[model samples]
Target: MAATGFGALDGIRVIDFTQMLAGPFCTQLLADQGAEVIKIEPVEGEDSRGAGPFRPEDELRAFGGYFASVNRNKRSIGLNLKDPAARDIALKLADSADVVVENYRAGVMDRLGLSYETLRERNPRLVYAAIRGFGDPRTGNSPYSEWPAFDVVAQAMGGLMQINGPDRFTPLKVGPGVGDLFPATLCAFGISSALLRVARTGKGQFVDVSMVDAVLALCERTVHQNSFQGEIPHPEGNRHPLLSPFGLFRAKDGFVTLAAHFDAWWVKLAGLIDRPDLATDTRTATAAARVANNAFVYEQLELYTMQRTKKELAAVLGGKIPFGPVNNVAEILEDPHFAMREMILKVDHPGVDRQVAIAGIPLKMTETPGRIASRAPMLGEHTDEILREIGVGIEQAESLRAERIIG
Candidate 1:
């Protein structure tokens, strides 16, 4: 038998009805931590399967790098929720599953008769988690609740874009799907907590994650600035509002971040910049003074940094002063630390000829470390197997396939 990589959530089974980033990312975390994740896709597959940069040769299989990134270490079972027979199979799967995770809009699950109320009647100990652009039912519905949301939309409306960018004149959205991934990680944490409670008390709970809420939670520093001090935060480019010498500076080749958060480090920074006078200068001595003379202090730091290469700056201040170079994707991929941690992995797929490097699981454990057992499943690859386990026989499974209920 294959080692299941069963760690914390070994015996727990998750029926995942999530597609794309938020939901899949949640389930991938669970899968990585030893939960058995059975992803239920639409009969034709989730829209993500058709999304691209696709492999030229295998259009049907290697749909997109985006989908491939988050859906690893999971099993895919296709079901047409619109069909009665397929719905029955879904209910059966839910009955057997300890948790059900979905990112559907507010009322979609109820319309499909797969709502928690209905599913809990079958299995009362099922943890139901829902991820959304906004909050769940308890928060009340909004005009845009039903409207589909992309990461950019959430970032724009959820206050992330407001405080980002170099200045107020130019607002920038965060590069990756922070709007989605943040909420997904929060939802995963809540879901696991609910599962732990279920194990102890034989009771299930609802887990709701709002992308907007998650984004707001991440803006904690901004909140503290506004709420306590009545100071409205603006785009301050690379400098930390409170902590001086704690942002990016221009090095010879590129940019590097120097987080001299402690006073000792600030003293060291003054030495590094060859301004020993600034170390004890009353107008630039304390943290408050450094904040007051922010422009002057940053200018002094930049002058020294601009004379040295990023690598040279890093060599001097990397671990000592909490400094790091701004690494792009290519630099990150080539980094030795990333390789040592196995952040990059090689995997073979029937669809893709040569083994390509994919991201490996981030959570490491000594006893039962996670593994990338298989590639993301082709649409409906495990449909028959999952259905049969749920009490649909081979003949009935074939009939459902013919009827477009199973694909």
Candidate 2:
């Protein structure tokens, strides 16, 4: 593994009090960029550590794929926050840290005496980022701000479940946690912006991201269509709502997609498919005519496409028309494009002897490059080393271990 002490964020220290996907994913990005991200896990570890997809060969260690996927390039320090000593140590760690990220329900940090308001009093220039399921109440009297929520609930209430799928008859949530990931990305951005402001003003700020707000921002197009055009944007299946000839169609072996959106491309498509007559036909001549007769035009295209294999159709349609064959996971893994771009990276993990391949970083930068250096850590793997760095001595660290404050 390459030394994490030399990445782009080399000098930036992040005290992470977050767990599960969203918060961990955000910190992982920072870790990859060279931040010294110290993940302060509870003594038992994060909820994601137990949530599996575990390796059958190694069940004892914290090697769950879900946890590993979003938590590489970071060190873990176990701290039982319920313990007063551990809480004190956590504050000490946060005081010297450049940034602190948390995704607990709004008031959980306050309950733990680790809120931005409290911590910033001790570390004036610290950047604090928080993620939530929904916006905090503007005026509140209840102690319910500490309630927890998962990704699925965020999806259901965050407008994602309303806009996804074929139609109003059956609304489907997105395949991945779009709600969680969106807010996570935004939280990371907010943290970066806060860090910048702190650098200039010498004053830290609190950054909050709501999964519900993020999803609504993502669904702004739907909102605009309904309000401006009086068009409730129903899911048009695989087809795009505003573009013609922009959907999947049947091929002999499987499915092929088409996107001949421009009128000039439609002319070329007609020629390639040997349907020149339909190119100038009264019902299909102009763009509006073609869109009005889209059902008939699509049915005709499918008639020809269904007789040809995906490979055959794609070969013929290749740049003459914009098209692609439906590719599955196996196909994607074997694809030349993905391999050439280094979209997959092979890592030799401690638990697994053989190398395991996972998706690599998407961003490509010339100077400050990102690399997946280390596999996810075992629970409390760096507990002693990290505690010592936080000014705790070896003998005191041992006592903390004996007292179960550090595990």
Candidate 3:
């Protein structure tokens, strides 16, 4: 059979009313799959465009890496939804789209008269998705629904930070913006599910994802540990609570992680280290015993590993065992795996002379592969063409421009 052209979502159109990470990331996933994602932003642009990491040489600093990274493969339209005329234009766009996704607080869309109920009246088959700090009241009422939250806040409240530090007394938020991103990932899945149902039944549904709930779901082990064990799971440093060698290890140049947790692998690892006695020692024999003496186990492992470089360790353990070096961004750029898998991409930046590196699509489908359709658009890049497509005359467009409705 022939492979799918462009992407699996070639025919789908998305009206993206997302500004920052959570919402934009979700829409970006769809855009990667060849959905015609029309990103609706404020007159200036989306909020992240103002955020930085822009090259010092960039004169047209309208957008930066933070915005460009997640916003690739989408068109941008600048509209002031506070204005009734602009709201009407947004409604038209939403009605025309197969999906509409936003990350505004609970009532923001309702205030703008672009609520799901309002749009579903015109397009019953439109999938409406929302990402919120707590959640929409329609699904479940949270006491902190009105409170503003970001990635760290969700990580803290969702039990992830509680079990992520060197000790229980010191909690650490993850290095990444997992709170925003995890919810974005889940919301993307939800939107896809809703779209599938819409195709099958010719009916649309509202897909809601709570940011805090998503974080809690991600740290699901924390819940069962407390319930089943009658004990709270504490910060585990870098090692597993039950497994012996399932976490990071010290190395000469950098760190590496090894996972010789099972008995077979453990014995092999002991033999590799020329410490056969470790396999027979009652203190470090089985998985349970190793866990009981984890501190002693790590100290002994470090005595051997601390003398070798990350590359040297990889040479010994690369495919023979579940081992990986803790690489930074530079190492990742130099690694062959990312390039071979197409996980790192170089896309043209609007003003930058050189091509900028952004992440490539992860969902590899044999029949319908995802692809980057285009680089991220400039602010209001397609306003004229989009207005023309929506049947607005030149004079009418000029009037909207005059009124600061569409940028």
Give the winner by TM-score: 3
TM-score preference between candidates 2 and 3, better one: 3
TM accuracy, model 1 = 0.95
**For each candidate, what is the lDDT?**
0.83, 0.81, 0.89
Tell me the tens digit of each residue's lDDT in model 3 across 1-407. 01124787888989999988999999998888878888898887777997978988788887899998999888888899999988989999987999999999899999899999999999999999999999999898999998888999999998899999997678898999999999999999998899889889999989999999999999999888889999899899998886887999999998999998898999999988889999999988899988889998898889989999999998888898899999999999999999999999998887789988898888999877888767888898888788888888889988888888999
Candidate 1 lDDT (Cα, whole model)?
A: 0.83
Question: Please, what is the TM-score per model?
Answer: 0.95, 0.92, 0.98
Segments in model 1 whose C-alpha atoms lie over 4 Å from true places? 1-3, 56-60, 139-144
| lDDT for predicted candidate 2 compared with the true structure | 0.81
Model 3 clashing residue pairs (backbone): none
lDDT of 1 by residue, 41-92 (tens): 9888898876766666763564567777788778888888998888888898
Encode model 2's per-residue lDDT on 1-407: one tens digit a residue: 22565456778899999888899889988887888888899888888887877667764655677888888888888999988899999999998999999988877888898988889999999988888777454333234344566677777765667667776656787888887888888888888888888889999887877777788787888888888999866656776666678898989999999988678998899899899987788877777777777787788789889999988997899877788899987888988888888888876555666776777777676678777878777788899888877789999999988988998
The candidate 2 region of ten consecutive residues with least summed lDDT is 137-146
Model 1 pairs whose backbones collide: none
